[model samples]
Target: MARHVLLVEDEANIVEAIRFILLRDGWSVSTHSNGATALDTIRSVKPDVIVLDVMLPNKSGFDILQDLRADPAIGNTPVLMLTARGQKKDRDTAMAFGANHFMTKPFSNSDVIDVITRLCDDPT
Candidate 1:
């Protein structure tokens, strides 16, 4: 089965780039821009992986991750948190919220592919 990946990011260019690369790498990619509706989209899509942005319109990525962790149905879904800040605090917060992986903006395409692949492969 083709693995599904949902990208929740407001930046147009980043969304395009990640979508293109993931599609090229044989992933079924879905995207959402609004933080307000992100959780609803995620539950409906039930993607295998999620690439979430830290800075969003209505809610922050940290809040989203926390919510995901609290929900049993989608709690274990792998999440790769993205942050433009690139600060230790952001990374720490993501980990604390149960994100499987985290990446900063301007990340290499290979890194994104590799992390997603690894997360999918990991049984626990």
Candidate 2:
């Protein structure tokens, strides 16, 4: 089965970049820009991996991660949190909220593809 990836990011450029990278790597990529509706999209899509942005409209990625961790259905879904800040505090917060990995913005295409590939290979 093709691996599914849910990309929750507001920035258009980042979205396009990650989408292109993952798609080229043979992933089924779905995108959501609004954090408030992100959970609904996730539930509906049931993606194999999630690429989430830290700052979002309506709700923050931290809040969404907390909610996902609390839900039994999707609690174990691997999440890779993205942040433009690239600060230790931001990375630590993502870890505390149960994100499986953290990557800063302006990330290398190779890195994103490689990480997503690994996350998909991990057993759900």
Candidate 3:
């Protein structure tokens, strides 16, 4: 079966870009626009990896990451966190919250592809 990715982002452009990239790479990409329902979507889909944004509606990505880490069933799933603010503090916070990888917005397609490929291939 093809690998699955859950992209939790609110921006239409970003979602389209990511969806195109992942779909081209032969991964099944499912998108969730609302932060309030992101976790529920994750539970339903059980994606192989998750690409989450820092800013979102209803809930912050940090809060979602916290919930994911707290749940033993999905806690170990690889999470690649994206942030518009490239501050060291944001990166630190993501790491502290158990994010598998951290990425800044305006990211190159190749970079995103590389990170997702790595995460799926060797999700540790």
Candidate 4:
């Protein structure tokens, strides 16, 4: 089966671009503009990986990451957090909250694809 990804991003244009990239790479992608809805979808879909944004409506990516880690079923799931806040503090905060990886906005599409592909292929 194709790897499935839950993409939580608020920017419509960014979402579209990332979705297109992931789809072209042969991954099934589901998107949510709000973190609350993303949480619900994550529970239902149990995607192979999550591409989350830090600035989301309803809940922050860190908050969602905390919640996911608290749940045993989703705790170990790979998550690649995307944020415009490219600061050491922000990156450290995401790591503390259990994000498996982090990427800043204005990132290269190829890099994002490579990271997600590696994460999906990891057995752990």
Give residue 15's lDDT in candidate 4 (0 to 100): 91
In candidate 4, residue 50 scores what lDDT? 94
Model 3 Cα lDDT, one tens digit per residue, 1-124: 8999999999999999989989998999999989988999988899999999999999999999999989888888899999999999999999999999999988999999899999989977
The estimated TM-scores of all candidates read: 0.96, 0.95, 0.97, 0.95
**True-structure lDDT of candidate 1:** 0.91
Expressed as tens digits, the lDDT of each residue in 20-72 for candidate 4 is 99999999999888887777788888999999999999999999999998989
lDDT of the candidates, in the order given? 0.91, 0.91, 0.93, 0.90
Instruction: Give stretches of model 2 more than 4 Å off.
Output: none
How good is model 4 by TM-score? 0.95
Error of 4 at 59 (Å): 0.7
Model 4 lDDT-worst window of ten: 115-124
lDDT of 2 at 43: 91
* Tens-digit lDDT string for candidate 1 (2-120): 99999999999899999999999999999999998899999999999889999999999999989988999988888988999988988998998888887887889999999998888
Model 1: runs farther than 4 Å from truth? none
lDDT of 4: 0.90
Residue 67 shift from truth in candidate 4, angstroms: 0.2
- Considering TM-score, where higher is better, how would the candidates rank from best to worst? 3, 1, 4, 2
TM-score of 1: 0.96
What lDDT score goes with residue 72 in model 3? 85
lDDT (Cα, 0-100) at 107 in candidate 4? 99
